[model samples]
Target: MRVLLTGATGFVGRGLLERMSALVNLELIAAVRKPVSGFPENVTSHVIAGLEADTDWRKVLDGVEVVIHSAARVHVMHEQTSDPLAEFRKVNVDGTLSLARQAAAAGVRRFVFISSIKVNGEGTPVNVPYLADAQPAPADPYGISKIEAEKGLRALAAETGMEVVIIRPVLVYGPGVKANFLNMMRWLHKGVPLPFGAIHNRRSLVALDNLVDLIVTCIDHPAAANQTFLVSDGEDLSTTELLRRMGVALGKPARLLPVPSRLLEVGATILGKKALSQRLCGSLQVDISKTRELLNWTPPLSVDEALRKTAKHFLEQQSK
Candidate 1:
């Protein structure tokens, strides 16, 4: 199989490249904005000016049977752009559709898109989880753009015979992780006391390896065609339980104070961190049964094993 992968320098993309390169039957093409170094021998790099609608992708799509679209404008807590929605849509919707159209014309067999779980909603009720077939309820600009891209991809698939597979993944964490997960790991590594003891909200998270595993499965699975699936680690964890387990992996105690969730919310609101608080205190579980049943796929690593690997990497990076 000849697969063209975008966002090869990103966390998830890096994981995919590392694993897919080892497959003897696969030839990987990494589409990156800039030059990437130290990739495997089986992988080829193609420099892209940007993921704009005008960017030409003829050479990248040549001889590619599958296109794994992972590049996009990720969500930011504070966006500096004047029109965040336009900026997000430029890459996530317009660029994505342009690429998919070109891929379809190039006779690409399958186009696998990596989308965000935020498309379902910000969070679900305590006991209710987000299902794969749920009506999209995008609450943010990023999620809205993803939903639009999914809709466009599906429409394109209907028009063309190309298979379109969409995988909506929750928070992905692993080695080289950054943003909120990295910050939390830093706090835990330094033994800073946290106030998440009262947070009992369950969240679904996917390890980079597990997500890559599913992407590989979708590339060849016949049933994955024209399907949108939610991917996760299968095991849900409360905020406190997550912190405690992470602490265990890092060989440290979870120095969490027993603070009320309401008090924490108020404090976060006063500190202009209401959104951050919600992420830490809200339930955003996903039901990934469709992915498992459709592809006969299961997460290769358990949550605990993934956490330990993440902790090891964080420590190594910190020591450097």
Candidate 2:
């Protein structure tokens, strides 16, 4: 199979690129903005700079059987742009549709879109997990753009007979992870006491490897056509429990303070971090039964194993 992968240098993309390259039966084409170094023998590169509605994808879509699109303007916590939605739509929605249209024209078999759990809303009620077909309630511009892109892809699939698979993953973490996850690891390394003990919230997270595995599965699965999936490691954890696990993985004692959730929320609001507080003290569980039953797949790695790998990678990077 010939596959074209976008965002090949990104966190998840890099891992997928490496894993796909190891498959002898697959031919990989990486569509990246700039030149990348050290690709495997089975992988080739296609330089497609800026992503926009008019960005030509003729060359990149050539003879590509599957297109795994992982590139998008993700959450900009402190966005400086005036019209954030327009900016997100231009790249996430318009550019994505442009690629899908060109791929359909080029006779591509499948287009796998990597979406986020934010499309289902930031958090759910305590025991109510997000389902694949749940009504979309995007809470931010980035998530709204993803929902719009999903809508467009479904339309394109219906019109052109091109298979489109959507995977909504939650907090993908593993080697080469950055942003909030990285900061948490850093704080853990420093033995900082986190005030998440009293807060109980369930969050679903996927390992980078697990997410890539499911993406590969959706590439050719007949039942995956025009289907949406919610993927995770099949495990849910609270902020305090997650921190404790991280401590175990990092070989550190979990120095967590028993802070009240209300106090934390008020403090965060005063500090202009209401969103962060919600994330730390909210439930965002996903029900991946649809993904498991329809695709006949399960996460290959356990949560503890994934966390250990993540912690090891963090330590290695810090030592370097």
Per-model CA lDDT versus the true structure: 0.94, 0.92
Error in Å for residue 53 of model 1: 0.9
In candidate 1, which residue pairs clash?
none
- Per-residue CA lDDT of candidate 1, range 1-320, in tens? 89999999998999999999999889999999998789998899999999999989998899999999999999887689989989999999999999999999999999999999989999988879999998999998999999999999999999998999999999999988999899888899899999889888899999998999999999999999999999999999989999999999998888999898889989999999999888898899999999999899999999999999999998888889
- Per-candidate TM-scores read 0.98, 0.98
Report clashes for each candidate as comma-separated counts: 0, 0
Error of 1 at 51 (Å): 0.5
Could you tell me the lDDT of residue 6 within candidate 2? 92
- How much lDDT does candidate 2 score? 0.92
